[model samples]
Structure formats: C-alpha cells, structure tokens
Target: MAPRSAVLLATRNVLYVSIAGDLIVAAIKVGAAAYTGGSAMWSEAVHSLVDSSNSILLLYGVHRAKRTPDQEHPFGYGREIYFWSFVVAVQVFALGAGVALVEGVTHVLHPTPIAFAEVNYIVLGLSALFDGATWLIALRGFRRGAGDSDLFQAMRASKDPPSFMVVFEDSAALIGLVIALVGSYLSIRLDLPILDGVASILISLVLALTAVFLARETKGLLIGESADPAIVMSLLRIAREMEGVAHANGILTVHLAPRQIAVALSLEFSDELQTPALEIKVSELEQRLRALHPEVIAVFVKPQTALGYAEAVERRRGKTRQIVFHTPSPPGPA
Candidate 1:
C-alpha cells in the first residue's frame, strides 16, 4: 500500500466535518419530525440521515483506496474510491431521494396537518446553521484547480468526486430547507395541509436531481476520466524538453484515485542514442516526471518516430477509438 499522506486523502477533512454536522442535524431533525408530524421535516430528517451515511461510505472508500497494489490488482486500490462514490450516488437516489418522495406522496394523499409550526421553524433555523457552516467548509477548496472556469464548468472538469460531492448535497439541502419553509408557512397560514407535502415533494425532486448530477460525474471517474488537461499538457512539455527526445507524441493519463494517476508517454528519442544509454535516459525521464507530479504512479514509455507515431495513431483512430468514442469527423491532413 502506498503510504498515507494528505494528498492521498483529499477532502477527508471535509467528509469528517460533513459527518459531524450531518449527525447532529439528523438527530435534531428526527426529533422535530416526531414532534411536529410535518412531512417536510420528516423528509429533511431522512435527507440528513442519508447524508451522514454517505459521508461514512466516502471515508471508507478513501480508506480502502489506500491499500497497496497486489497481485490481483496491480494499480492499487485507488479507483475503489470511484466505485464507492458511485455507490454513494446510488444510495442518494435510492434512499435519500426515494424516501423523501415516498414521504411526500404519502402525506400528499393523506394530507396530515403539521402541529406546532414553531418547532419546524426552530429546527429549520438550526439545520441551516449546521449545514451552511459545513457547506462553506466544503466550498473552500472547490476552486483550487478550476482556474478561471465558471462554477458549472469547474464541476464538469473536476476529477475528484468527494472534492465537490458534499457541495452538491449541502446545496441541495439548503435549497430544500427553503422550499420546506415556504411550504410549511403557506400550509399553516392558509390552513392548507397539502402544501407541506408539496414542499416535501419539491425537496425530493431536488435530491433526485442532485443524485443524477452526482451519478453522472462519478460514472465518468469510475470508467476512467483523464487527469486535468493542464496536468497532461505540463507532463507533455516535460517530455518534450527532456534530453535525447526528438518529439513527444503525446501522453495518456487516467485517474486511479483522486490523487493517483497512471501515465504513458510516447516519445521519439534521438537515433544516435543506443539501447543502454536510452535506458538511462528513460529512468531519468521517469524521475523527472514523478518529481513534478507524484500522483503519476506508473509511466509506460513507447519509442516511435514522429511520423510513425502519427501514422499509428491515425491507423487505429477509426478501428479502436470508435469502440470507445465516436468522433464527428475523420482525420484531416496535417
């Protein structure tokens, strides 16, 4: 197993913070739901409960991902985090969103009146306080590698699931709270009990949408999304600048874990370089690449001339790539 480090454990502190706040909030919400019989409050309690459980799963995923590479899985357990994250997404949709919707529909059909509206108001206030603080903590590093990209773009580009998953959940929670507040207030003030159920339904929709978003993001990682474009570009520059290299064809990278990446480089080295000398150069090259990006756990070097590399890339373009991706256009002349 790779030694544990802060890098390997990205967003761990965030998960810890999330679990603590969610546990406290879940308890408070559960109590309030029992006291008030508000459908929205019950939904909120369930949401908090699911959030707490998801945080535990994420933490466990992070732990399991740190296990050493073995004969069964040579790339280490890094991508196990992706698998668990996907499971979290499934849980959100199945448990969190599904339960909220079920509760909403049940109350909508039954139209149960919420008692002691003040209790819900007080609980909402406290829930917001707790969720808001933790949301802010999760948001702190959201833009770390996003550069000048907008929020949605940054999220799409993010390679680390946990780095932003909590944000989605917390943001949905806060929105659902607002909706619940509105639903409850109108239901009580207007003596329309169904509005509270409507609010719960709305919260359910929010969670459902959040789950879809999370699942989509996580699916990409689980299947293998590339490292950040900037990371790939930087490593390509490093390869091109290395001694004895004539051209750096390109590099391929996949995130084995949030902080773990596997890289392969195709480079055209000087023809004068003999096999033994080329071996030393490749070793030094790997050292330089690792020094720059410790996340790059494995580097496979492929030697080929520029023209040969281009031809090889072109020949395999339609044959193999089409199996994975469908390009809009065939290759054009250089």
Candidate 2:
C-alpha cells in the first residue's frame, strides 16, 4: 500500500485504541466520583468525560477528512481537522474547565467534606497509568509518522489521526489525575477542604491554557498558512535541478492540505530547450519532483520569455533589497 494510506490506517488504529482507553478511563473516573463524593475526583471525572468526547469528535473528523475530493471541495476535507480540533479545545474549556472553575471558587467560599478518599486515590492512580500508556502509544505513532518536523507541526499538516487527539487528551488526563490526587489527599488528611477546590482551580487553569494554545495554533492553519519553509526549500532545490530550468525565477508553494502542497513556479530555460527535448525534460522533472517530495500534490511550471525572465529577476532583487532594509538586525560590527 502507499505510504499515505499506511499513515492514515496507522493513525486510525491508534485512535481506536485511544478511544477504547478513553472510554474505560472515563467510566472508571465517573464511577469513582459518584462513590467517593470527592470534589477533586469529580473534577477529574469532568475532565475525562470531555476528553472522551473529544476523542469521539476526532475519530469523526478523521473519517470525514478521508472522504474523496469533490467538486465543491477539490482538496478534500483535510481542513476539517482544524475545525474539529478547535471545537475540541472549545468544548474542553467550556464544559470541563469552566464548570471546574465555578465549582472550585464556590467551594473555596464554602468548602465541603470529602469521603472515600482511598477509593478515589486508587482510581486516580489507575487512570494515570492508563493515560500514560495511551500517551506513549500516541507518541510512538507520532514519531513514526511525523518525520523530522516538530510534533505539533507534523500533527497540524497531517490529518486528524486519532492518535494526535489521544496524545493531547491523555497527557491532560494524566495531569488532572495528579492534581486530583494531591487535592484529595489534602482534603482527607489535613482537613483542608479548600485544597480540593484549589486543586480544581489549578486543573481549570491548565485546561484553559491548553485550550487557548490549541485554538491559536489551529486557527493559523485553518486560515491557510504557508507550508513549512524546509518543504518550500526542497521544492526550490528540485526545480533548480531540473534539466531545462536555467534559473529558479520564482516559486509559490501553498498548502492545499496538511502534508499536501501545490507549487507554481516561474522557471527559465537554458537558451530554451527544443520542443521534443523540453517535453522530455519536463516529464523527467515531474517524475523527479514526485520522488523528492511526496507532499507535493500538484506542480505547475510556467515558461517565461527572456524579457519576462529578466523582469522576474529584477522583481526578486527588489524584494530582497526591501526585505534586507525592513528586517531588524542584531547589533554587529560596522
């Protein structure tokens, strides 16, 4: 099977495992919360519930994103990942973090007793272990699929593989579990019930921060940011190596989808190849490009007249000069 297909399948499998883990964790936490009557456990339970929901949303997005390209959306539904990911963050903040904060603040004002501390602690510890293992699975999938890029960037450019959501959700769940344990211990041992509330507030803060970060990052991709600079440079190198391309006049690379890019380049031929030779060279170049960058979804080569080539060179020079003048520089020798 193709690498892309393999990656997609691998992602799906990881997500499936993650979803199972999430459901189990959520069920355990909810049961513990109901039985223990501990505010910290309840807060953790809320976090797990949202995380489980987010996993379901991610699975849906992944499946939707795999739909074949259509007339209205020729690029397919890859960007749907961004929308769904953003929604996940919003949901986490609204349902989990917001509720926790309100309850925490209220409890701080008027604290309450907690019962069945031992059971809550055992449940939290088990949840933490499960979350940790799930996170490792996600991390492994990420390392296998993302190549040399940053983890977040790899995830952003790629489809909404369930493993990506699994990673974030599990990591968050682990933290929430730790906070709940601390708070529960304090409530039961020290008779400081407010620590339970404080713990909840701290978990909320973590969730809010997580939501804002996810929103900020995904929003940029949803709005159509450029592909990675390294990827662009690789494309440029491929163009420069083409037999007929005398000079790389200009290249425009845009992300049509995560890990899929469209390239439009103005290239100059060396004294212009003969018709047959140009055709052969172009075919060869296209083949080479596909081999070099699997991420390039489409490439359009624009032949330039000599005069047009000169104009393009001059434009690039002008742009370079402007960039040099406008860009800030650190202090240096005169």
lDDT of each: 0.89, 0.77
**1-334, model 2: which lDDT tens digit per residue?**
9887887788777777777887888899889878876777777878877887887887787777777789998777777866787788888889888988987887788888777777887898889887888899888988776778898777666543354657766777788888888888888799999998899898888788877766766677667767677777887898898766888877777665556777877777878578788777777777787798887777788877655766667777784322323667788988
Which pairs of residues clash in candidate 2, taking residues 3 or more apart in a chain or in different chains?
A: 157-258
Range of the 10 consecutive residues with the lowest summed lDDT in candidate 1:
318-327
Highest-lDDT candidate: 1
What candidate 2 gets wrong by more than 4 Å, as runs, is 146-163, 274-283, 305-334
lDDT of 1 by residue, 176-288 (tens): 89998999999999999999999999999999999999999999999999998889999999999998999899788999988788998899999999999999999999999
After superposition, which runs of candidate 1 have C-alpha atoms over 4 Å from their true positions? 1-4, 8-10, 143-149, 320-334
Native-structure RMSD, model 2: 7.8
